[model samples]
Target: MIELLGKNLTELQAIIVEAGFPKFRAKQIMDYIYKRYIFDFQAMQQLPGNMRDWLTTHCAISIPEIVTEKTAPDGLTKKLLLKLSDGNQVETVLMKQHYGNSVCVSSQVGCAMGCVFCASTTGGLYRNLDTHEIVAQVLLFGSLLKERIHSIVVMGAGEPLQNYTNTINALRLLHEKEAFDIGYRRMTLSTCGVVENIYLLADEGIPITLALSLHAPNDAIRREIMPIGAHYNLENVLAAVKTYYEKTDRRVTFEYILIDGINSSIENAHELGTLVKDFPNCNVNLIPVNGNEHIQLFKPSRRQMEAFKNIVASYGVAVTVRKEMGDAIQAACGQLKVQHAQKQSE
Candidate 1:
């Protein structure tokens, strides 16, 4: 069945016209699906009964079902485990911040990156989600909030750049005026330094913020932690990001995960600063590692975290620690999904 949820107005027009319906019918379908939040074709009262009946047979408006939900004690953060049509589940996070509500979406069912600290790699890579599946995550989470999600972060579960086509298409659909109407600037995409895709995304002309997961100051330490580092070294990754900034004129954000005795040393912070200091207006966001059963790495102390940030700032680079959110409910990207799957098997 054709997925109507991911199609933009132009694609929907072609589908409708090819199916012996008027082109204008596509607009009405868009209104019902996006504006009215109606998913069933049979309930679209404005459409002719015969057209509705045809749509029901040929197309589908699918949304993932929530399998489990965990909310933090403060009520500011909620994590949802959504089960897709094929019974594959992915986790999405809703964080209500002082500015607005931001949602984090997963690009694949499971991850292949093998980032040692990330629980998403616990099950290996399952499958890349379809474009509609990716878009549905944002829409479903937005509906739960009962308000428009002001920003989106594709930093959950899988390596988004690995699922390049679908991830990119989902962002485009969400930015459409006929759909979510969210601005391009409100989106942030995180990658484990996929060099080829970094160059590719820069040419696509989307001005979304690019957050490179630079956990280590050099290639040697990165290889110790993330398997992907063996393939693309820090030198190449940093160069790709530099090119990306030049092309898009958007400041890149370097995401450094602070793990105790690993990448949290004062010297490591100075090396990090030297590596990124020459880049034009880049920001370094330090995230304290969240230890799980699978990864034995622990987060650095608050004093250590602050000291490291101060050293990085001395290089005339902007650096700050990322605020911890949704800690009580296991809000890290794949933590909830891993726990749910473990229970199902038991």
Candidate 2:
């Protein structure tokens, strides 16, 4: 069945016309669904009972059902297992921040990126999520919390850039004034350095922040953790990022995950600085590494992390260590989905 909730006003109008309803009814449906967040046709008071019944029979408004929920001790992070229509479950995380509640949405049932440390890519790629499924994740999470989300990160279970078109369409729906109306700037798209999509996203001209999962400063270390790193080597990835900056005029955020004795050295920091020194607008964000079970590396010692950051900064590269959030709940990126998949397979 076709999904109705993710369609924008213009697309909804086309669907309404095709469904033999007056085109004006599309705006009425939009008001009920987007403005009121009501999916029940009976709740659409403006629509006639007959029309509501017709809509119910012809269209489906899909929302993921909560299969499991784990809340952190601090009461700030909630990890949810969302069972999709196909009975496959994907994970979404609701994190409470000082600014407001932010949700991370998954873009695929499984991932193809195959970042060795990430469980989402472990069993191989399953299938890509449609635009509707992606948007539903945010709506379902927000509806349960009873608080409007102020920001969203497409950095959950799947590599969003791998499913480029649908990911972009979902982002568009998320920002629609009639729907979530989230500001484009508040939305971040995190990629594991998909060079082509970086250029594609820049060409779209949206000012949304772009995050590169640059776990290593150079190609050799990256290939050890992320197999795709071999195909898109550091040379090519850095050049693509340079082009992206030129086209978008936006500072790219390079995400560096610090693993003990791995890519956490002062030399690695110097290499990082050299790679990005020319791009004055970019910032390198240091993430104390998590997901040690999949990867047998410990989080860097505070001293080591600080030393690395200081060295990079000494080279005139702006660097900041990302504060850990929802650590008690295993809400550190990719942890929840990995746990859920293990349980299911057991």
Residue-level lDDT of model 1, residues 157-248, one tens digit each, is 99999999999999999999888888989999999999999999999989999999999999999999999999998889989999988988
User: What C-alpha lDDT, on a 0 to 100 scale, does residue 57 get in candidate 2?
Assistant: 83
Question: How many clashes show up per model?
Answer: 0, 0
Return the lDDT, model 2, position 158: 83
Best candidate according to lDDT: 1
**Which regions of candidate 2 fall more than 4 Å away from where they truly are?**
344-346
Q: Candidates' lDDT values, in order?
A: 0.91, 0.84
Q: Estimate each model's TM-score.
A: 0.97, 0.95
- Cα RMSDs, all models: 1.2, 1.6
Worst ten-residue run, lDDT, model 2? 289-298
Q: Largest TM-score belongs to which candidate?
A: 1
lDDT over C-alpha atoms for residue 338 of model 2: 70
